[model samples]
Target chain A: EPLGLGRPATPEEVAVWDIDIRPDGLGLPEGSGDVATGDGIYTEKCSACHGVFGEGAGRWPVLAGGQGSLTDARPVKTVGSYWPYLSTVFDYVHRAMPFGDAQSLTDDEVYAITAYLLYLNDEVDDDFVLSSENFAEARLPNEDGFKPDDRMEVEFPAFSEEPCMTDCKPEVEITMRAAVLDVTPEETAAKEAAEKAEAETPEPAAEEAASEATTEEAPATEEAPATEEAAAPEEAPAEAPVEVAEAPAADPAMIKAGSKVFRKCKSCHQIGAKAKNRVGPVLNGIVDGPAGAVDGFRYSKAMEAAAEEGLVWSHDELSAFLADPKGYMKGTKMSFRGVRKEEDIEALIAYLRDASE
Target chain B: QDDPAIAIKPWMQELGDGVDVSPYGMPSPYEEDVKRRTVEWLTADPVSSINFTPIHALDGTITPNGICFERHHSGVAKVDPAEHRLMINGLVDRELVFTMEDLMRFPRENHVYFLECAANSGMEWRGSQLNGVQFTHGMIHNVQYTGIPLRLLLEEAGVQAEGKWLLAEGADAAGMSRSIPMEKALDDCLVAFKMNGEALRPEQGYPVRLVVPGWEGNMWVKWLRRLEVGDQPWHHREETSKYTDLLDDGTARRFTWEMDAKSVVTSPSPQAPITHGPGPTVLTGLAWSGRGTIPRVDVTIDGGITWHEARMSGPSTPKALHRFYYDFEWDGSPLLVQSRAHDSTGYVQPTKDQLREMRGLNSIYHNNGIQTWAVDADGKAENVEIS
Candidate 1:
């Protein structure tokens, strides 16, 4: 209003633009097309694609029935199930129906088709006159089903005018629980590993062979420590003398190989410098730390219960979990299928001992 | 005439294995840029609402099958084309059914047409929120459709004299359907089976979709399946709750189908900034009507201060796209560009303010007023309302 503008659009500008329609049924031209008239127009023009009585034909979409079944597995949402208004049917039909010959409908025919569509959806009874005059009073069934989303009200509050800092909240609570491991789909892992393996095999075949041989030796050495511990309990006197004599001579090659196998546990358990708690508890201190005891990470109910019963991540406890993650801790979200190979499990345990210590 | 034709690469060189690779085919390499346009922040949920079809990116006549705009109240139906069946009961003279094979038995015809949503550009009535023309005007598509006429199919069923309305239903889990009048059915309705001389793409109803030329896209139900004839109208939810327009007086408009004549300049608009320099600038746009073929389109460079008749190109099919061009010399001055269209019946496109005045601002559907594009001397276009 502040800036001076030219005069309003002229009558001629308005005359060329007479196709507008109002929802109150105002500006609706004088004419009527009822259910009966619409039926005739429909059978002759629409039934081929839409089907007779608004049930669609073939791969063509059906247009009628299944009302009041919105929550059902298969909602029969035609114009009846989901349409919010009757005027859309009439307006759309009048402008485009019979496919390819749009706007061919006269004002009266559109009204008649509108009336017929209502009759088919069972929204109107017989003798319903859907003319421009009485069009405004008609109400649809799902009128209350829709309401504008008020997310803006809640979302707007989240974005505050004040700058946020550390004191935004005194404490953060962990109400819901989640897993420690990032489980990947078989296909995704296979694809990633396949490409990497293919490239690695072609260029550095000898290096890969050497690593594989070292990996085999590392698992054997890892099991020697576990075997000695188990034998020590069985023969206390004899095992003490044997362990004291052979402990210094334990296989170092197996330990070196086992350390490389720690990558599998890296996502859930951590090791070395800057290794904090993750989905699972930190492995750096797990050799002596109580089971499921990580500073911030929440453990599964099974793991927590195990820790309450005096279970610790000893070599035996760790071996059973490494064999089968989900089986060892039921209800845990860790989806890992487990290490099937015996040697790989040994390698992983040896690697964990070297890293955890 | 500086007309340059790009070399058409054969299918072998372009698509690799061609039709054999896919039981269904795809768009050519030349049309790689044409695709369904979308906005990430437009709606909170992806399944609830999606914007599609770059109507501005397409040229000539047909909207290639791969890029047809799709909007489903429910998700797109994943129906097996083989198990597809159509039943016609209700008040018909005789209850009949047809399979996908049976539908092919009827004689078919081909025609080029455009399907546009009534809500296309409805968001821009108050103010333009979207930047690209694809998002603003992407809810429309033009295709050379192939189908059997509805009249022949009705004759096969032997419609009872009392049968007045035919309710068409889809086999989708949503059971998407709409009520169609008998008169419009016999007049010009076609049970379209193919688009652009190819089988209907799975996204555009696969086997068949009702082709209601010049009508709102909703009535042209995709994945069609059943038909019930009745003597009364069906007040389906789509008709009453969704598509109806509400006026300022709190009363709602009903049964107002048929897209009024409308036109919009596609290229050199905001989404498509004018790249070529000033000399002999070719300004192109599209015009159409549900009423009939678009007769003429007037382009105004100085914001409707003056107008010039644009040259109509290609075949002027009813309810189909008509490309219009206005060649002019540009002096690199700021220009407020707009296009106005007239149908065969002399109906002209209205301005934004005039439409808002008459309809009273509350209506969400059926806004076919003239669209204005403000172009700077730098050739950047912006959607503007002309007072």
Candidate 2:
């Protein structure tokens, strides 16, 4: 007996959108997945940004480790160390995983990924199988680390007390200043890198000469020193950072076709000289470079791990990556849907090679 | 008598542009700088980020819809009103869906409330970090919303007796959702469609949004598409993983909903420096509380050496921004300036030390501590912490 304004929703429609799973395992679907299966799915879908071991790349979420570091300064809150419930892991992965391509995973895929994450966190054995029936059995280590908000009982009484007025303190001295620390979020790492690059090459005349040479010949020599200087701080000591490969003579038709296809990436990415990082990292010299190699540009955890695990952007690798970024690199920050046509991919690669040179 | 220069001015002699010049009105060219600005590195990208309201340049309580601070989890969704449908499901007796036209049939109410993000001054939990009031306390806006009372909608749907929690879900790309206790939903919640006498802005959830007055901004799910009644709270990603307050003891506090009383001196701050030579200075600020109305606000110019009650102005409505002003003759001396707000619940804005002592330093949300600004003799201001 309600206001008859709209029709009753069909069960099928509700089932499609009613996707949230709860802590008590209320909405879990009938599906099963094991650690081995999860590992394969995770490697194909998630490892590009989350890493092989669930160690987050760049500023994406860290999913493993940090078991007992909550009380320490700069605690790493991850799935193993911080998440209060295992259901949250399954629910989050099912609902919002792969960053941009959310809700695209099958229930079995979600279960497998969740199990793999559990294995990465060391909560599950390698042979452990996770299903709707046994999902409740997997409990998070930090299950007891949360409490209902106690602000009213613990904080309100003390904070509500009448404050002192008139000569509250004898003499006030400036204890700290924001300008001194200068840790404002507006002060970006890219700006610092640019400044450092400028400081290192103080001779303005040399910079002008290099720019002229780059424009005339698009020489690797002109760009190498600049990118190398910026990469010095982030590069590991043991491994030598790979330099961009010299481009072969450009195919004019292929480059033209690639330039047309590059429009899809131009919204989030920039290229050529004077291109700065935008929503996505600058694509200059990215064709043959290692994954997650851009200086001052934060990459997803999976991308960082892939780079750490020796992921070089060769032609076949780039083709596969561009074909299905999420499917190939899981958890990557890149949101672009793959170029469907094979020709578009080849043309894009050719354009990038020519443009980088 | 008119001055000779003004009488012979070009604008005075010639006709100005007609209405045909602009199909839609815009802010004057001189007011171009008065805009929402974001701290670029605050988030991964602009799409899933927040922008600060230009509180430094604004006066009065009502914030214009154009310049209100925007927070988006998956960017602004362009939802067509014709295609939008609000569904009420779960524990309700009848699962109902309403079109925009069907929703307009219900009796509506107009209420002015200040929607503040829980992390408005979250950065200043350690100390005075952001140099400007806009950056420190700009994640808030007071707007007159026109909508139907949530209680009416829930009653129309006929909520089952067992339902204690309602999960409000948005239609945006993130599908932002939050669990609300039935008590709060019945009290002051609104399924709003219009703001400031016009259809909601696309950035502000154009078709419809849930307006949980006085609660955190995230709870006001934009492009609100569904409400699911349940027996218990849904510890979703936003609730458990993101919004929860982590403490130093390795424990976190969850569902800490209500925002405490807070205030800040807007003018004569870093961005809105005192350009004129020091004479009669009017120190004005905004104070609000989620619990109730701000009954009083105390201003301290000598770093709490002396406190004076500022004069409260306009309607002192519950859960709305209350403007206060303190006029005084300036002595042209360097001084530490601060404002402390006290709500009707007898809650005074605590100092940074007191808040840190209670909740610890790890929390990234709910830092409603008293803000301090140091003004130099040159009429310039800087963010500083006093000992």
Instruction: Give the C-alpha miss distance for residue A60 in model 2, angstroms.
Output: 2.4
Q: Give a tens-digit lDDT track for model 1, residues A37-156.
A: 777787788878665656554333446654665543223445676566666566556544645565677888888877877776767754577877788887667555543323224222
Over B96-143, each residue of candidate 1 has an lDDT whose tens digit, in order, gives 657787788677898888889877776554443345567667778899
lDDT of 2 by residue, A39-140 (tens): 888888887766556655533456776688778654567788888888877877877677667788899999999998887776876667899899988898
What TM-score would you give candidate 2 relative to the actual structure?
A: 0.78
lDDT of 2 by residue, B172-245 (tens): 77878899999999999999999998989999998999999888898999999989999988888778777778
Measured by DockQ, the strongest candidate is 2
DockQ of each: 0.02, 0.24
Local error of candidate 1 at A136, Å? 20
